[model samples]
Target: MFVKSEYQKKLVHVKDVLSMINSGDHVVSGLAGAEPKAILSELHTAADSLRDVSIITCLPMGNYEFFGNPQYKDSFLMEGWFYSGFMRKLHANKNITFIPNHLHFASTKRLDYKVPRIYMGNCSPVDAHGYVSLGLSAVYEKDMIEKADLVILEVNPNVPRTFGDTLLHYSKVDYFVEADYQMPELPVTEPNEKDKLIGKHIAELIEDGSTIQLGIGGIPNAVAQALKTKKNLGIHTEMFTDGMVDLVECGAVNNSMKTIHPEKMIAAFALGSKKLYDFINDNPSVEIKKGTYVNDPYVIGQNHKMVSINTSIEVDLTGQCCSESIGVRQISGTGGQADTAIGAQLSEDGKSFIALYSTAMIKDKTTGEIIEKSKIVPMLTPGAIVSLSRNDVDYVVTEYGAVSLRGTSVRERVKRLISIAHPKFREELQKEADALMIW
Candidate 1:
């Protein structure tokens, strides 16, 4: 419709684009569903011709061989901001390592370390006026594309065209590789009985007209179901999932009472079911923004009665939460756990919640027996990294009950947290706390 012929000159096959890659280049792939599968899937075919190429990825949807297979270690090294199962399983291969960052500063921090040589992502077909939508994610893709030596995008008709900062002029992108594929989808995670109990407790804490941020998991979905009866809720989050779609369809999230961006849902990126993609297609009510602004504490604090809900792997008596690790083993990334928690606290009358199960089942290494271990402990596992510090924790919920620790003293926090732990481990935790003289 607008300058179509002018942009068509830049079209190229995926193999031709791969020829531009050279040794010692820094390649950045799109986030989540925005990943350019056609280009990435064939990257390894050219790997034998290159050497020492570094790649930066965030929440990759598919496991491309460049980083997934240890055999390609000599030619490519993966530096990820966040990891999926494929990357985590190959972490010990020595070709992949985590690049620690907060969601808001992921792009900025990386550029400070090394500028990108190439930026690749998925986008909707060019529209009238010579513009293309970045589609599913804006998280940090836009930031990388801005300064990369080359910009190549997979033009997929199946990608949902979204609004806000997801648009880019055709002239800015170097090449367009035609693609025909369905966008990746994640099915809804059904909540278990324990998830429902924790969800109900959290639902009771939220007031009407409140805005909320939800992380990925059954607990968040349960929270979504629990909030179905609420009126005029709003969404301002890092990752928008299908649960939010359910809330909107149910009329619970009208966004009418938001203090900022009223009547619209704001997010950095989205991931979930095919239904979720269709709901956001050309939807003016949904805005896909950059992670720098969406996850910023000051920006997130502008919402009315903001509520941040997230999950954890384990929590200690003093309110420290190890969410992304098991001892020294990395499971995920810090993501926006601290960002949203602090931002919600900054909002007037806003609240942040951390939820988890009371206990976990573990096999005893020495006796070969299965036992129930408390997720609530006097101290974190020896090498566990603290995802959320004690100062930022607000409310914590478990199947047994919920506890609030805002402005609470150390001794009081110990008591409150232990009270909500599984009954079988309460006394054991108390003795550990006393022996350490931590409270």
Candidate 2:
């Protein structure tokens, strides 16, 4: 509760802050939409001068030009909970540390660590009281700012001033830099016929009064497209995209039937097209809170009829979901998928869905034959991370069918899962399931 100064503030370029950092210091950038691109660029440029600097954060958006380049390979190290395009490129580099945890817990745990410096990012200008809003990403920034020895501010006027717990007292910031650039805009990839069909089938599982938790990419976008006709649909999700705009306009996402946040759209954060960002700007109907509240199992269960839809890289016949890894390789982290799944199960009339395409490839790896490969595996490869266990999954949706496996015995659940798997892989999956004596 420190009082901020309305004194004539001068903007300090990011290079000034970069020069002040010493070797072996821990610096964490604000997560998601609140990422300070200007500061990050400056740090990248100064990588040669700085050494052994550890950066801990979640999926950082936009172009990452100098993350693990050879010129500064030993300079900066990344400790991340999830993988993005940049992380994929640096997968082989052992310098990048991968920590597996739910997104909600990561946001909360970031505070307990020894933070030498914290970067405070914002989109709006200083108010009368000299407070700045955290824009689309108020989600874990408050904690980062509170526990740091030095607080650096990126004052971007173009960042939207979103509502809810998003304000920061200017006095907390040790350095100020004016950076007015448009936030990163996520592009829309149109859905194909197969994707549209999958979306249609998934849409059928959603009722009028269901509150939803969904992830990103074409599948979630396609599913949102099919939900435009549904009535009173509420969104209590981790992140929203451009697809949600249509549902809101059609009066479908009225949030009237939601038992929690009745008139407000509750989300941890958002990353989407420019229009989507502009739509949420100062819009009171939307409440952009921290992930701690939005992704909490207890908060999500307060709503009646909650339906959590998440994607997976693969699912085993025994119902293990590997959303964060490909076999033994760690591709991402166990994010809010487990949080929402468990939350949906605890709701009074809720259902959790693990949806993905039947096949990722159309070639047989062992037989050297042209055949469809199943994303639904007989068993998860060794050391694969299971974000959602069999007991937590309520339903499994594919283009073929939807199987409910919550209360069913292990043998019965295995049979139901194999039945919904791709037709080409059914026989192989059945043989494998039988070998496990599951049926």
Number of the predicted model whose lDDT against the real structure is largest: 1
What CA RMSD would you report for each candidate?
Answer: 1.0, 2.3
Query: After best superposition, candidate 1 residue 209: deviation in angstroms?
Result: 0.6
lDDT of 2 at 323: 88
lDDT of 2 by residue, 1-439 (tens): 3234432354567777788677898877776678888877767787777788887767877546557564566888877767777786676665677867787777667656565465546556777767777887756677677777877778888878788777776776777788878888878878776668777888898899899877777788788888888999998988876777778988889889999889898888888888988889878988888888888899999999998989888898778898888767787778799999999988999988888888886555678778657888877868888988877888888888788988888788878988888898889888888887766
lDDT of 1 by residue, 1-439 (tens): 4687777798999899889999999999999899999988988888889999888888787888888788899989988888888888888999988888889999998989899999999899988778899999998999999989999999999999999999998899999999999998887889999999999999999999999999778999999999999999999999989999999999999999999999999999999988999999999999999999999999999886999999998999999999988898887899989999999999999999999999999898799899999999988989998999999999999998889999999999999999999999999999999999988
Best candidate per TM-score, number?
1
Taking all chains together, the TM-score of candidate 2 against the true structure is: 0.94
Please give the distance, in angstroms, between residue 349's alpha carbon in candidate 1 and its true position after superposition.
0.2
Compute each candidate's TM-score over C-alphas. 0.98, 0.94
The positional error of residue 281 in candidate 2, measured at the CA in angstroms, is 0.4
Worst 10 residues of 1 by lDDT: 1-10
